[model samples]
Target: MTTLTVGSHRIDLSIPAVMTIVNVTPDSFYAGSRTASTETIAARVREAAAAGTSMLDVGGYSSRPGAEDVSPGEETRRLAAALEVIRREVPELPVSLDTFRAEVAERIIRDYGPCLINDITAGEADPSMFGTAARLGVPYIAMHMRGMPDNMQQLTDYRDITAEVCSYFEEKMQRLQEAGVQQVILDPGFGFAKTVEQNYELLARMHRLTGLGCPLLAGISRKSMIYKVLDTDPADALTGTTALHWECLRQGAAILRVHDTREAVQVVRLWRKFRENS
Candidate 1:
């Protein structure tokens, strides 16, 4: 089991935990997850907390493949609004800021105090990200992606997806630890830089990544790996997502970053029961 320290809150990871997604961007790959207004963000936070989510992940920038890039200023403003609502309405719940920009992360930490930083770039996009995370002393989530979102799909030329991803984490984890980051979580970036086949391949061998000795976060949620294979849309991929969530847990994932909190929470609960009995 792994533990994550976000501010004064210490998250015990003996059992799998759910990190619910609250996207403030309009162009997120999943249409159902886009929440722009403060009222909607507050409502979503309240709902996710009630549904038993262990953490709330708020993102202003859209990281979907080929997604339009938003400036740091805009991203900061959007995140500030969302965080303000979360601070006011659901201050008790731990929050994770989903951004790869160091400036945006620094601003959020200064204003919001200590929280988790879920950087998709793994500190590659912004050279200052690791230092900023270390300075703030927050849990950093390093996701494995080969390239920028606009061109990541074309860069999926890994000789061995799992091994390459594991190697990537091994290198990045060393840098993060050296920079004084105490807690680092691994996210395999399921749809960011991999082909549909590669995504499943990595998931099948996900347990191999556990040797890195960090908590694994599986963010398959309503991603294309589920919908594309099922010949369905993201809107209808909940069943498939739930199925894969079980596989991820069985493979040693400590966290599930998901758009649908209730279903994921149910998955974690049932998976825990199954693991206990077996």
Candidate 2:
């Protein structure tokens, strides 16, 4: 088992672990998962933590395509409220802040002390984010995407899907390392920059990314990568997410960023049991 340390928290990734999505905004793609109030957000965090979620990703901004953009102050307020409640309720739970803006990250991490930063832009939005990660000394989740939330879907122009993504990460890794950020995780950003066919193609060749030598975080939960192909909505995508989660685990993924923590935990446990007997 491999354990990833960010700050003082240790995420045991020797097996694929589940990261529960705790959206503190109203505009997240999943309507059932949004919790904005302090009471509701704290209750959900405790419940998910008890349900075996290794980390809770609390995002105030919705990165969904064409979603409305929130100001840095608004995002900070929402995250601050949620983090305060979580810290009061369970201070030991490892929490990750999902944002692409370095300014927001700097402010929130200073006020709330988050252990990890999961940026969807992979530090592309602002070049200063890598230096911010180094200064904070937190594990940075570098995701691959083509553009911002508003125009990303339009920028999906890729000739060689796998090679291009690997090349992007190679360049990003070099840039981040030069900036002195060593602890980084790679997320392929399944639906951010690909067609449904390209999503599966990347999953089929998922092992190629493990060659980067960083922990792999697969975030296909309720994403368009699964639901759009199934001709279903986000609420009905749990089973499809679990199926793909298992496939990712078998392919050597270190973490699974998901909305449904209980189902993901079950999948990882069952996969481990099956492997042991096989």
Please list the C-alpha lDDT of all candidates, in the order they appear.
0.92, 0.87
Clash number for each model: 0, 2
- lDDT by residue (tens digit), candidate 2, 149-225: 78877887788888999999999999989999868899998988678888899998989999988889999999888
Estimate the Cα RMSD of every predicted model relative to the unseen true structure: 0.9, 1.3
How would you encode candidate 1's per-residue C-alpha lDDT over 41-113 as one tens digit per residue? Answer: 9899999989999999999999987678899999999999999999998888889999999999999889987
What's the lDDT of the predicted structure labeled candidate 1?
0.92
Index of the highest-TM-score prediction: 1
Error of 1 at 173 (Å): 1.0
